[model samples]
Target: MRWSSWVLFAAGIATGANAASLTQVTENFGPNPRNVGFYIYVPDKLAVNPPILVNPHWCHGNAQVCYTGSQFATLASQYGFIVIYPDSPNTADKCWDVSSNATLKHDAAR
Candidate 1:
């Protein structure tokens, strides 16, 4: 099947009982201290409360670079789920600070 048709089929399977529109929203988790920006996909018709999928970029990778918000967005729209792609706090390498205490605390809070 074509890619478009596949997407439609998947969407139909996702919203088998209830269907809703799709939306993409950008949000910054830590605007004051750490700038952890993320993109969230919200579906319009949710039969039950949607589940969230957190996607973290690779080392030296930015959120925009890692998650293009295309395939995942389409899946979220069809399946009634929320997708979150978080940007790294470090600007130099654009990598998450897995060893830093401060970064750990900030991430835990978020």
Candidate 2:
């Protein structure tokens, strides 16, 4: 795996899933910025109320390009609950910050 791939792999592990399984597809969703992705699946028969995330795909990749949001849904759903993945922006350091660093927290007050 490449250096960045490892980082993505680690994210999959951190999410507590055994492995990452993903595919590429275009999905229709609410007003979401470009790069958003999701893999809707039937909730697992076992889970009553599964956990979710604010921006699951924020740091993850596209299907398999970076992270496996589709696979994540497959697993997360099989385990019960809903999984809504968001596409995070890709920027330097693998993070999104169109504005300069000095503008991240407070450029107005300065």
Candidate 3:
């Protein structure tokens, strides 16, 4: 799937329930040239090969803000799925690098 599409999918889930705190993952999953922060919310109970939800925060926001301010984590807990919060590498404004060529390309040097 495209990188930009996950935002819409995450917005469609139900909200307003309490969830566990987000966990920061230091393990390198791939070539993170931009050094984006990876935070995940894995429920106490997980389904078999459960689906994942990538929840990115808005401008001036980070993974912690997105995780605590949204219902994706709560939904993940209730529905047995995983929620991944990808933080922007940009430290100034904290917005994603949507204008970059690498970001526009799929399976690029991520």
Candidate 4:
């Protein structure tokens, strides 16, 4: 089956169920020079070594708004995967620093 069709089928299975909301991660994972906000959504039934889905918000968008407005949380619940929503540190424009090479390199923000 097509990937899109499979997702739709899975989402349909838990139509009335309440998916878990995103939770802010307080503990530091590592150096965050950009001061980006981290949020996560863990499904009730998690798959072994589940793949992570990073859902970064668009310009002028925050983690909470993206979580509530998108299907990532619901899909995570249905598919038993983890979802991460990272809030950009660029408060001036509320956008990610994609133009900078430092931000693009692996663990460059540190």
Say which candidate scores most in TM-score.
3
Looking at model 4, how many pairs of residues clash? 0
- lDDT tens digits, residues 8-101, model 2? 3333433443223332224232333334344322342425444553234333243233234245555665675434343444543344444765
TM-score head-to-head 2 vs 3, winner: 3
The TM-scores of all predictions, comma-separated, are 0.58, 0.34, 0.75, 0.74
Error of 2 at 77 (Å): 5.6
lDDT of 2 at 109: 33
lDDT, candidates in the order shown? 0.55, 0.39, 0.71, 0.71
Worst 10 residues of 2 by lDDT: 18-27
Name the runs in model 2 displaced over 4 angstroms.
1-25, 39-43, 54-79, 89-94, 98-110
Across 7-106, the per-residue lDDT of candidate 1 in tens digits comes to 3344444344333323223322223356566444445654365666667889887666655634766776678675556677677888787776766674
Query: What order do you get sorting by TM-score, best first?
Result: 3, 4, 1, 2
* Model 3 poorest 10 in a row by lDDT: 7-16
Better of 1 and 4 by lDDT: 4
Residue 95 lDDT in model 2? 48
Query: lDDT value for candidate 3?
Result: 0.71
**Would you list the rank order by lDDT, best first?**
3, 4, 1, 2
Location of the lowest summed lDDT over 10 successive residues in candidate 1: 21-30
Give residue 11's lDDT in candidate 3 (0 to 100).
Answer: 27
